[model samples]
Target: MQALLFEPNVQRIADETTGPITYQPGVIAPDLAASWFAALLQGVDWHESSRMMYERMVGVPRLHGHYAADDPSLPKVLGAALGIAKAQFRAPFNSIGLNFYRDEHDSVAPHNDKLHELVPHQPIVLLSLGATRTMVIRRKTPPHLKTELELEAGSLLLMGWNAQLNYDHGIPKLRYPVGPRISVAFRVRPGWSEDGW
Candidate 1:
């Protein structure tokens, strides 16, 4: 009976699993994903940020943008995408965070979603658009088991709340050339701040 839930490209990564994570491909259809990617790339105001790393301020490799779910300034594609996510996983996701990887040079260091920033027990919904990038998810404890998924455009990945406590995930810089990609991450922010635009 459970098998029926994940037909086609759905993958429930549980073997040697330390956390609950589900990945499904072709959620938005390829053409629509491409169109949405184009819209988000141009319509959204992307920005750069730096954080104190190793006792020095270092520039982040990728661009970032954040928004509230009901913000009037969000592009139409985001609303449409959010509708799909909510329909599939009924969660109280009130925040949206976007990461723009301009090229292979743009990468995020392995890290987990900060617990203080998210509401307890709420899942994190992630949608991938544009170029496919491999995400490395690994256990933070002994044995350090790892898994890799090539997040294709139109794919959706759900990480359970407990997953963050047990694992770390991120995209590493690729040596080969790759097209730009956008990652739209939906979360339930505990105490939301300003993110209209």
Candidate 2:
């Protein structure tokens, strides 16, 4: 496996490995990752807007994507990182969903990607950049449990099968100040959205 950084250490989150979902921390070389991110931020058109959810699900506000046009270098590096991540965790991934969260108030509520748009048993690789924020992952049950973690810039978080199947993840709005945040979410979704536009 090609290491994103030699001697990179894993930061473990509080979760029962026996309980289906596992969140592992990975790191990429900042300089390299930043270059790709810069290219992406420059190459793609980004908009500040919100998306409404169907059937009263939580809505997503202040987000944008960098996937509407040709991005040769960004996707390659991201795909390579996903490859390493898959081998490291024994998970499979292919496509990437990139989002820019502009500030403290910009947020995404608890929700999972539509199942029909994903491949069963594959994982999602989320890479965070620019600034840090707390990502809350909660299970769907009484007592209403939750786990919150500060995802630092240049950090990678992987959500596997059980997570996608059983839990919901999101970045809640914080009243305090926070800088811009960019998240690159990579996944495997064969023949899902080929219009690529």
Candidate 3:
């Protein structure tokens, strides 16, 4: 197998008080990205998501799916992809979450990953597939520093363990047309399975 490579111009979006947020473009081989994207789109059991906003429930603009560690039910392609990520990152990832952005309108609100669930100091690895989209990260406190990044297909983002402490990240809605995209986030949660939490 050929070794995976990242773009030379890796960007670090962080400051003195916050943990590192590194973006490595082209982490997946370009030749394989197309096929992998297609397989995941068809294989994962994706569904619309919603959450309580203010006093009312609102539908999230994207689709979502999840795979627990050692889940035998995952499709072969997704399982293989998970294996690759685990080997590449060398993290004890216990869960995987998939977010599908069907078009330019799908977006996620700025927020940090829930820290109570994740094991501290373990980086979260996010792999991007399909269309490129912009991700924004902003400081949670005064000064309110911010940065924007174009998350390209086949890219990988490593969010440091402490990155969540001071910053919030999200994918904002775009007005222009964009094809579908998928992001797979690998994490090491405290629980063994979804039910354990």
Clashing pairs in 2: 95-187
Structural similarity to truth (TM-score) of each candidate:
0.91, 0.75, 0.91
lDDT of each: 0.87, 0.66, 0.85
Which predicted model would earn the best lDDT? 1
> What tens digits encode model 2's per-residue C-alpha lDDT throughout 37-89?
67666654566554455756554576676442223444555556566666666
Could you give me the TM-score of model 1 versus the true structure?
0.91
Q: What is the alpha-carbon lDDT for the whole of candidate 3?
A: 0.85
Give the clashing residue pairs of candidate 1, or none. none
**Alpha-carbon RMSD to native, per candidate:** 4.2, 4.2, 2.2
Which of the two candidates, 2 or 3, achieves a greater lDDT against the reference?
A: 3
